[model samples]
Target: MKKAVLASALSWALLAGCSQPAQTDQTIHQVNSVTNSSSVSDQTTLTAAQYSEQFIAELWQLYPEYALYVGYYDYDDQLPIANPQRRAQELAWLQQQQATISQLLETDLTDHQRTDLSLMANFVKRGIWQIESFKSWQWDPSEYNVAGGFAQIVNGNYKPEIERLRTILKRLEHVPAYYQAAQANVSKPAIPQTRLAIQQNQGVASVLGDELLAKAIASDMTEAEKIQFEQRLSDAQLAVATYIDFLTELLPEVEGADPVYRLGDTVYEQKFAFDIQSQLTAKQLYERALADQKMIHGKMAELTTELWSTYFADQAMPAEPMAAIGQMLERLSQVHAKPAEFKAAVEQQIPELIAFIKANDLMTLDDDKPLVIRHTPEYMRGYAVASIQAPGPYDAKANTYYNVMPLDGMPAEQAESFLREYNQYLMQVLNIHEAIPGHYTQLVYANKSPSLIKSIIRNGAMIEGWAVFAERMMLEAGYGDFEPELWLMYYKWNLRVVTNTILDYSIQVLGMEQEQAMDLMVNQAFQQQAEAAGKWRRATLSQVQLTSYYAGFSDILVLRDKAKQAWGEDYSIKRFNETFLSYGNAPVPVIAELMLK
Candidate 1:
């Protein structure tokens, strides 16, 4: 799966907002000052921009980990405890923020400020819905892990090593209480989430283990501070271990509820609304995907026929479109990186992609931001084979990691299947979608956005859509010198995007079984066995996320066409791209409304 971007902790990762200062006195005082003085009626006195800043600070107090991930360190030492008291606090805060935003939206404001305010309003509403209605915190144990947040601090370079270590030492104080609250809050846990929680927690050693201790020992901390740090780290490790044990024990007991990973139609639809924030509804997106799938299949068949003589001159072309296409794909799939060489292959393509973008003058490429291709973190594994971990909007200078899962230890047959799925041509498309002018590039632009509201309250459809759009844009610009083979493979890659919408909607809402889903992906979508299986696992583990690719891609394509006609002779791809991206990672429909105006 070409999943991109890990936004710190997953609980409120999508709801980007605020972070506290590193100093406790200042952080508390600033937050308290805002809360004590600010009210909905008072919000009308402040400009939207000023109110937004205040609201973000209050949100940071609620979700310190999210702030830390986004490069705000004020709440570095704090971790939220998932109990009724905290939930109630979150609900109250969101309600107040929602009312304040609604009042602000009624007053006069700049278009930019208005957009930001609207995004903040939506984010507040989503948070309220998540607590009062969606309530994943009550059922999803995987939502409770602290490892990713800690890893963000330890692995991050926003501060000096010693300073970060001190922050970590302070944060460790909350670990035991956080887990205890997690244990109390979860009820009727989904089996998949329980297993994922255990699996992810096993990675706590990566952060709190001897390596961190070694760093502290080598640092400039005083002896007393070092001892205190050591004790806290040990306790934090025990807390994580205990949480894992609790989950392991609870797994079999929850089987009686016939626990499911799939959220039904009603829940899935609402999540799509909040998570995607697209102009089209989930059902509308699914219908478009079905139509798109047929169109892509027709094109693939035409390409297959065109290429048959080149690869299979010795044999007759099959009368059936699918059979011909499948055979051609099998032939092309033979060209792939060896399991050991996969990461190296991706690394090598970075420069090639950069050259292509610049040569074509697709858009301005930032040379300052570094892209690092590395092994997928242990804590983040089992979901996607490759993903991008870009620095949050606050920390743009941090490395944007292109996390590629190593193929080591996979059974030979499985590894071969996997490689075939990500074959040579499709791999290039994946890079375009996940790196270069895809997620990494888009996120960098997102951070540069003047509006923090837009940056933090990011729309998944806009983010994923741009990456999907990047795939086709790069190809159309003649990246592969118009190779029919490359174009044929590109069609297959596009099929993955289209089918992702179909697969997600089908499984989550329509109850698609494994056999039917495999047939849809492997046979109809032309995915390899390994890729299809991994996607099926991903579909079950997630809701609404799979649909983002198609949702965003379709929205972007439509918007670009509109921009062409609206701008007329003024239109240029570079202008459209930069202008569209300038709005930060706001939803495509919002950007379209602005640009087409």
Candidate 2:
């Protein structure tokens, strides 16, 4: 699951009835009784699928933020409350439902039916862990930020201005209770998380006071409506401000306390199983990443030697292959975008890349989908260089923002290095991953899937893997001249993903400090100083997430090769991607079973 969306699933209504932690064997038999007894269209199978679908949809109502993300506006006005009591209730209900779903007679369910049930099971397992096991409610302050409650309102125009604002105001009324509960429940706030929450709350206040209400919500309101809107927003600002103050006040108490951010091996591995649903364990994934890292480095070395001969045919070759590769890449760095032109270059290249995809039939081009490029929200920044804040699977018309953070405020040397790393060729690769045929394209198809279960229970590895795969696919499909320079840059980008897996496992599990971590990223992966530094923070703030790109990308590549061997002449990139992604964002292994079998 994407961290933001799942953590955002905080709602009192969502957990209202989860206190019922009991499931009977007969209830389990509904799934058990269905399997080979009927075809997919048979009454029994459809009955089971529909039953599970309804259960999944109803659960969506509990998370309004998630609803908005997915484009379901039914709960737009509601905000989720996070406290010990509600979490306990939600956890219990999840356990009961999970027991019933997990025990469904495997013989009775169709392949698709089993996949949906597995998706549900994954969600329940993660929910149980997040609540009872991880207990982030007690320490992760970012969990309590209501800014997202406001963001959902302003970010989407699924409803008219007045209607959306009214709904937002209704949710805003609960802002105080939401944060108050945060204060109550997060009795031991982690300092790093607390600092982030404070920063995020201030961002919410600015958007609410300086932009949202003043500009959009009350932009053209009647005098009477304006007064009500202003009052509601004024109150929201106070509640958010109060929470920010609490986090700020908490800074002193945590000054000497340990950071306590790593999930440790035990919790992190359990999370990997639920989120990734892969054949490999964390250790296996990390070891594979190490091998893959060396392999990619070797390829880059060979390619750079070719480039070195092209430019310096008269000179003696460097004894070490890495030295030659490093020098060649350094020269390629000069070909990057100027700081001022970085984002625009990315924007300009997208349509060109999409045109290429369509012309080559590499993948289907759905021109109907809407996309935009903009600065990332303050609350969402500090995680990655670029990311897609796409509308959830349910909402198609809403614009999927390709968030590109500006490097202006960064130290001059850092800014230049960051941009150079996102060089002209690399920007196109990043665009391919974050937009076009990457997250945006896959997500658009995911939205159209018959099952919402796949969308809600997003497998991080699958989502990231597809994006990483997309980058390679586009380059192989003949993007940007298929030149040695471009391919070398592409290898660097892939290296970043491979090193990401090794680096994260190294830091969080092996407890490798910054010195060693930096060496792995900079020396081994050849990442920029600025990029490596950002990843260190991101890895600290998150665990098991960075590894998804390598794990998912490599797994899907293996799946594609098998499909190629099996389909023979029928194997086309377009066909494979469509059939594979058609199943939605369930774990790749689940998709593999359905597609490969």
Candidate 3:
């Protein structure tokens, strides 16, 4: 990022807002006498901008890994400390910050400052709630895993090789402390989350000791320095391996592994408030998701019938389109990329998606921004098909990694099933959602926002929603020259988003059975068996996250249509896209207010 600019603005605003009284009037009565009764009230109060900057600085101190990822090098040697003491300190700090923010005078602030106050105050409160209220850090072992420390340092070219390795070695030296804290803090473990943590830690440890070290060795460093690095890496590997062992031993004794991963009704709602940042309650969202599921199914039925007549004209097919929808979906799945070609197929779709976005004038595209499609890191696989790891606001100029899972060397049947599930049509939709105008475009604008607070505390729903929205936007713009196959695939993929909300809410709150959830994915959503199975595991691993796609997409569509109606002839898709993204992934409602007014 252009740090000189961010620093100058941040330093000026924050210094004004957060500066302490120059001297605390220690000996006021000794020499100087106040002429008026209220003359001694000169304590410095931070402006909203300063408060926001202070919050970011303090947050980086607490979670240094984030600072590093966002291109802040000051605290790169440290990672998050998740022990009880750190949690308590974080909780107390948030409590103080929250109180300080509440007491600020709105009349003294600018429009941006007021919004900054709201965003940062909420950020502090959410931090407090996560530590004190919901307390997933208590059971979620994955939350405590500091396994990606080295990979983070080596993943990009944010700094010089020697400097990056210095930080890596500093962090590596603290590995024992990091895991020891995790071991001490995670008193209760969720079975699935724990198992996955252990499994991934093994991979993470290997990467840190072997893959990461090998990569770092290729960097510019002295032989003596290399030996020092190798020793530190070994120690770090031991730390992670020990953590995995601890989890493995604790797996049997830990409770809450019952296939049901729901956070009950009350907790789920509170999480929804934080995670979704929406006015709708869990019950209301569930009802909407159910309605959407049915609606999307109806749409799929129409598309499937059309596909069947075109692709299977002579075959003996069921008369009812609903009955034949499954068959048509299967036919579509048959056109998938081969196991080895899945990654290549995704890469090939990028230029096409970019072209479509440009042709439609959907939004301004930054051709100079860095984006690379690479294999998903070992430490983060088995969670999802693909992800867009956008550079943090601080690292705005760095690459946005599109991590796609590769199917190399997998068992033939598993690879084939995975390929069949993604297929070509859905891959196109997925590419649009992850690259082109989805997260990549939205996040770029976020980094450019004047207030760093917005990008720092981005709404998950907004980010996911834009990607989901992008998929629909592309389809509506006649992508693939208005191909029915594109529409059919888009509709089916849309079903995945809709069903995602239902599946997550059902499993997490309704205690929906694994079998029932799988049925919903495979039968209702038209997902392949492999795809359905992966989703079930993901739903087990997460709550409220899956809901973001549907919740966010639906809300964004509503806002866009509302804008269209309000603006009429002045309305343009390009304007809506640019304007909506300019708010830097704030909550949809917040953005709605900004756009509307």
Candidate 4:
């Protein structure tokens, strides 16, 4: 389930932008041209490099936040134009890029160069579509927007930048305008009999009122800044109030008596495909998930028997497998670290991982951007257990922060249990995923890539896929002192995969209630009751996010095999990794097309 969630989260984000662009001939041409050009490119000459670099620079300006997140900060203080007029202008810019890239494709370029061009062009077309058609601004109700706003303000431990703070203020000022626009544009076609409009409304308000508004006003700004911020706050409040009023007025206009807005099967299918990026029908995906779930269950059963016979030969078997697992977890938890301890662990492991990479002659690390690991703050805890906060676009120094949440406020017994769950082996798993040969390593190369478009459409599947792949790689390379516990950790990671697949299908397809999903999580995945409940809530809030890990890992494995088959004896692990990372994190199909060519 954990694996599935990780996979789904990554894929969900990618697919979110899939159906955004209204299909127009021009748009289709733009998308096709880029994809076709890349399908043929083969050369790596100076001219190709120049063209790629130039195109990336132009592309970066289209999505400022993405640019900033990727360490490009030329227009740090500026926000993407959200108004209809501005969107039209941005769309025009995309059209120009597409035309230019298409022209470039007509040049006498090598297959590799053409491939790179197609990749970049596809990126431009996608970006244009998302910006112009998706109306992400209209769907301001997404948790991502709220979470992004929170991350900017108080990632809790880190200080918010003045520019970021200013952007937040601006966004707040425009909230009322945003909501009004959404109200005007939003169409409520069908209402679900079991819709939780009230809960969603409350959730939206809490995020806006308590998290966004309160946090913004509480910031210690300069006198002038404060006044400006307050004005924006007033405007946002007014907008939200108006939105509530609009909702009330439209309540009677709804076609159905149910609180839930029924998106209908067609719309739901569109959303599902857009997010998953696969041609697989919903029924197909659901069946695949069920089959995968059963297979994982069998693997767990086999492992249980093997571990019990090998490791616990002297002791009597526990009544439940979870009891034995719990004992092992307890032993592992003894290796807990406070902030200082956590830092020390990082200090010890990072250099070793670096040395291993260098010794193994893996891809070269960028001396310019060093990776750093740190503890997560309280505020950001709710969103992620840990993450790699990518560097801003303008910032040359790229640091990947490995956030280890502190166990400061818990009761002694609870703290012990938590620590047991996060022992050394678990930490190593995280380190490999977030740091060396994982996100940090992959992203460093991605940051330096020539294609700006790939960076913008950065798929989470690729990101998590690489991390999960890296774990397996390390194991194959004899990591974790060749201990069974390390292998156990790998299996535990699959817990996410299993849980994600089951819950996604159960909730979205099988129509399993949240309570039932929670029960499955606790029983099958060994998640604590509270954690299981939270997982159920998250599943409802985020559909298909859990499937990304398994799906991504599966795709990556296929990619690896294809690369090996194509290169044969010429293939080197390091070279393949570098080549893969060079494209940045693109969709698997796109990446496969580029690599195979």
Assess candidate 3 and give its lDDT.
0.70
Model 2 accuracy (lDDT, Cα): 0.71
Question: What tens digits encode model 4's per-residue C-alpha lDDT throughout 1-597?
Answer: 121111001112332221111111112233334434542222233366676775565444444444444445454333332345444545665666677677777778875577666666755565564555544334323312222332433332233555567666655554554455445544542222112222233334444455554555667667788778777666665665665555555455654323222233454455544544544655565577677666765555555555666666788767676666655434444666653365577558877777777776766776566666565533234334556665533453635566655556656665555444456777777777778777777767766666655655556566676787887777777676667666665666666665676677666666677557767776666554545654655555445555655566767778899999999998988878788888876766667777778
> Which residue pairs in model 1 clash with each other?
20-74, 21-74
State the lDDT of candidate 2 residue by residue for 378-444, as single tens digits.
7666666777766676677678778787766777898888877887778888888888789889988
After aligning candidate 3 to the native by TM-score, how far in Å is the CA of 469 from where it should be?
Answer: 0.4
Point out where model 2 deviates above 4 Å. Answer: 1-46, 215-225, 252-260, 313-315
On TM-score, the leading prediction is 1
Better of 1 and 2 by TM-score: 1
Stretches > 4 Å off in candidate 3: 1-44, 105-110, 214-225, 253-258
Of the candidates numbered 2 and 3, which has the greater lDDT value?
2
Residue-level lDDT tens digits of model 1 in 183-254 = 887788878767777777787687679988999999999999999999998999899899899889887853
Please state the error at residue 511 of candidate 2 in Å: 0.6
Candidate 4 deviant stretches above 4 angstroms: 1-62, 80-140, 143-303, 309-314, 318-349, 359-363, 374-381, 392-396, 406-420
- Which order, best to worst by TM-score? 1, 2, 3, 4
Please provide, for model 3 over 518-574, each residue's C-alpha lDDT reduced to its tens digit, 9 standing for 90 to 100. 888887887878889888887887778788787788889899999999999999999
Better of 1 and 4 by lDDT: 1
> Ten residues in a row with the worst lDDT in model 3?
1-10
